[model samples]
Target: MIKPLSMIIFGQDAEQRSLTRMQLISGGKVNVVAESSDYAHGLDLVKRYNPDSALLITNGKSEASLDLAKQLAKEHPSTVIVCTGTNCLTETVIKFFRAGASEFLMQPPSQAEMKEVLEKIVAARATADQNKQGEAVIACYSYRGGSGSTTLSVNLAATLAHTFEKPTTIVDLNLQQGTAPIFLGVKPVYSIADVAHNQDRLDAQLLKSFHTPVSDNLYCLASPLKVEEADDVEPSHIELLLSLLRGQFAYVIVDCQHFIDATTVAALQQADTILLVTLLDMASIYTTKRTLEIFHKMGLGDDKVRIVVNRYVKDPDVPLDKVEQVFGHRIHLMLADDYRAALSALNLGSPLVSSQPKSPLVKQYIELAHKITGREATPKKGWKGGFSFFGK
Candidate 1:
């Protein structure tokens, strides 16, 4: 059985406050956590109890009632505020609701009316809890520049957005010379530099203005258009920008720069899962092993680091076991090598998953998305690439 809705009540009229408390307690669904005659004391009680609902009762004309309600709503969005007063005119009620009152009641509320109001608040809480979920930060990086990190980042983002139909944004953390926007064929007017500049006023709506929309669910916050603009974005700016984006987006895919600079380190620290993309070649493999050591030093656990072998082919030269032994972690995902198909998509300024939907390379990209999101994406019918049969 679910516990009762915890509540705090504040009223000027002691008789009215006592009556309301009696009604709420009788219902057996509302737990009166705290009660106060002073509005200021009530605010303190609210902070202490962290109740689900706050009942603010206005006796005659206490301006503090509305002020307290507004502050509570702003500070604790989870708490529902119900305003009840004798001067509850339609215009006054509208004003109270605008001040963040979930429900407004006349001075003398009957037992049934109080019960109904509490029921409504309880129901709304349940719905909100069901919808609330933590945002995912998928940061893709590579020790070597040519390991196809950006390719994997963009495609993984597109696949997550298209398959799950959730709001996704790709942050081009390759502040200088980042080509994530180029792969999507998007020219963003506002980039990460703008976010850094406007960090003081950065909110969901303001951040939305900086993104270049690719589709209904997918957006891109491109890198600085000018190389010098990248200098303006500091590690602190990257951390604040990503923290704001995480609240608004269901998935924030960070296309990280190859270098282990301050900005890149900031991204790695915030990521829910870091996709370490690498190729099977000697140079890429050796660099990745070194990178893993650095990750260990930084206290990044193996669970948070997912090694993705890009352009993978099961060649005898670099066996799978040897690669895992070097990295000290299993390869979480392997993307197939289809040079012609991949190059065509890159040239066309589109993600491979959308450009070549039926290709096996796209299928593997979808599977990689599944591995990250734990959601299976339906594979579309299409021509397998030339190397699909021979590819891993």
Candidate 2:
């Protein structure tokens, strides 16, 4: 049986506040670990219980609701913040949702409607476990520069590791400024340059000597971090090193440089899922089209490559279907427009999944993991990775 989750609710409204808590408790949506009428006092309850879900159930218009959700997302990191009010306005609801409200319930929802929302949260949570168990790998790269490829790679890698609690490793093959270590807060004594210099001695013991552990199950291959030493490493050296690594881990993520070089090709050949990321602009979309054409020309199957549109906003500047028409391929993944929040998470050295799990952008990456691995990823109560079957 699944245990109930911790939840926090904030409001000055009396009746509406109690009603929201009652519904969650009745349906087993949460354990109701903490409850407080005082907004300031609620922060202690939140920190004490460490709820996975929170609701701001104030009576009328209150800017405090908006401020609370933002703080919870920043401070709690893993908590899912939500807002519900009787006098909810369209603009206010939209603003709160944009402020990271996971689910919004209007005043006086029927028991069934409330049930449905809670169920969706539960179902999504259930899949989170299977995603941790399956053969999940997300290889992120770009067709051109400044397309936010490395940003995606760094965050997704850290997300898979810390958010899902899976064993994750990122191989930084960007000979110049391999950004994984910097984003992940890892430091390495040696790199692909050193790995190549001693490929003859590359084994579990030898490889362990050169790598840096970012978290319990997460590791990073810091690039040389200096341009002068990059020329010493070759594509073949990276290929050999990664081939050995693939056998040791469940997911092998390679942040391949934006090049059609021998190294990138070798990594692609070994990759189970390749993310061909591009922005929505004309030039970036054209690069994606060219990549598809080149892949076809090289006799490579399209099944392995996933076209992802990064930094996608619901704007009329370019229809997503038209972008597909240009590439003549459907975009499998469309990351949201939370580039600022995503960057803040990256800048703080914590991945988006941990910093903002319920953010639309994090949800996209979570969904992509489910599709790539063909397993559902719902949020889990205990362990947070590919599958719960491991370590038994």
Candidate 3:
């Protein structure tokens, strides 16, 4: 049985607060931990209780409620901020979403509406708890450039999020040429450097707010916006950031830089699984061998580091067996070669799963995610029709 959702109510109307509390309690799915008419006191209650959800009542005219909601969201990222108001204007809903509110409801919401919201929160919590044993950190690295490490990192994270319904984050460690933000089509206001500068005060909640949300379950922590800002980030910052991300997300995917550096080493050390991405060519094979040797020196076993050959063709000049023989390690996975599909997705500023769900490349990514998570694949809705090159 699911436990009742712990909630706190903050509103200026005492009568409205009481009514809301009674309504929630009648459903037997919400336990109102605290309620206050005073915004400051209610905010204090939220911080104290750290409830599952916070319901802010607004009457459209007051900025006080909105301000309280924003503060709660920033300070308590784990808590679901639900904005309830009589004014359901499109602009009002958009404003709350921009303020970081997760859900919105009409004032004195009906029993059915309230129940639906509570169920959504409970379901999300249950999914999170399912993976609470420990977070899995998967770092994608490539010793040679143009091996599609970034592309793999982005799509793999997206597959885990959209297909597997897992909470996942992708960190862009390619500091100088990071294109994660562009791939996800988001203009981030904060970057890894910003988080590093505030590392002393960083917590899971603060770190959660720093990332840009790519979808409901996926987020991206972009590299430094300015080229020189990369210098501000140190190896220790990467370690601290990964630690906090593990606490908040089920899976953390790091797009490591091509060359070995202090920062990349820090990320690799924390990774539970390392995907050494390479292409099916002699150059990539030679680099993979050297990289494997380095991993052995770093005490990362072959079991921990998996080789993934990207842009694989049907009959490569260098056969799979010969490549595996050179590295003395089996190629864990080989993704299909579809340059047009990949380039189209990149140009569209979207993940392959979103832009070309039916593409063989997307299917391979789904298989990769299943291999990582050890979960069975479920068929996605609206995916039985003819294939289209673009999502349009």
Candidate 4:
């Protein structure tokens, strides 16, 4: 049995609103969660309830109805908009669609037509949920600075974009001091702050406009340009932005801030895989342990949170087995220590995957990307071993 669609009705005329609600609820195909004759109150109810559909009755005020439809489509993309009006002219229907209405029904809507629309919405939502399950959101996070989370995020995004040949975006969540744009060698005209500020009017097209194109398939949603702008961002905004991006991009990579905050927690919670990056030093290990405890408290387990050791060297003092024994969890991956190559790439303002493809560090990144995608890493020619698996 299909789940009944939740809907909200908005109309200036109380009589029309009541009639529409009655028809919608007759067959039990639609559940009228709220009904409002006032536009402001209707908008508030939609935000509060976040219903599956919004039914706008265009009685005397067509312009106002269209405006409401447009606003709802931009702010709540998941909610399907259906407009009913007396004037079902060609131009009138076109205007509704342009304003983001999915379906148009004449005044005194038929139960059959409304039922058809509800069925379509349910089927469409099912397909969208399946697609979302296939998409991946990978977040690179650390509790201490200089753990190289940003570098890992940028290079991994680049490799995923190149390997999959699909659209991939790396979001810089280190609002105050984000450098993902610098690492990618692009100066973005807009930042995540812009997205938050204009969230009321944000849609897929508007979001694409804000992205700074790094490559054919790679894009960057930069951090705030001014440090003060970071204050304007909220956890709710991060959640909304990521949800929208998930629908548009094949992969979303988030470079989270070093410290734990509400905003960072928001991103971590949304991620399908959280790469807990850290160094092999005792201090860094302790910080990572604390972070793991916090994550455990947050209901994130070892399955979602994978520890990655960056800038790793084969130090006898800090053996991999001992670190695993201490944490009671295995380290997921270890990136080789290559200060010269990393510094050179930074100077060139490019990821090592692109600046120095032959570097071993780049191969490890490729391997990591392949592992995330559940594919075997391709072996490089002239190398005795295919690819080193330090995690093994």
Model 2 lDDT on a 0 to 1 scale: 0.69
lDDT (tens digit, per residue) of candidate 4 on 322-390: 998777678888999998888777666677776677788988888788777675544332211111122
- Ordered by TM-score, highest first, the candidates read 4, 1, 3, 2
* Best of the candidates, TM-score: 4
Over the full model, what C-alpha lDDT does candidate 3 score relative to the true structure? 0.82
Q: Write the per-residue lDDT of candidate 1 for residues 170-282, one digit (tens) a residue.
A: 99999888988777776679899998888656656777899998876889999998899999999877766765675578899999998898898888986888999999988
- On lDDT, the stronger of 1 and 2 is 1
Give every collision pair in model 3.
none
TM-scores, each model vs. reference? 0.67, 0.61, 0.65, 0.68
**Stronger candidate by lDDT (1 vs 4):** 4
lDDT of 1 at 3: 41
Local accuracy of candidate 2 as per-residue lDDT tens digits, 292-388: 8986775556777888788887779898888888787788888888877876665655566665666788777777766765555454333222211
Decide which is better by TM-score, 2 or 4. 4
Residue by residue across 1-392, what tens digits does model 3's lDDT show? Answer: 23467788888788988999999899777878668777755565665455788888887334777778788888878788888999888998888888889888888889899888888899887786565543589999999879999999998988888876779999999999898777666677789989878865666677777898877688899999999999999987886687567667889999999999999988887687899999877788888999999988977777778899899886756788888899999999999999898888777667888778778998899888878878766635422112223443
Candidate 1 at 100: error in angstroms? 12
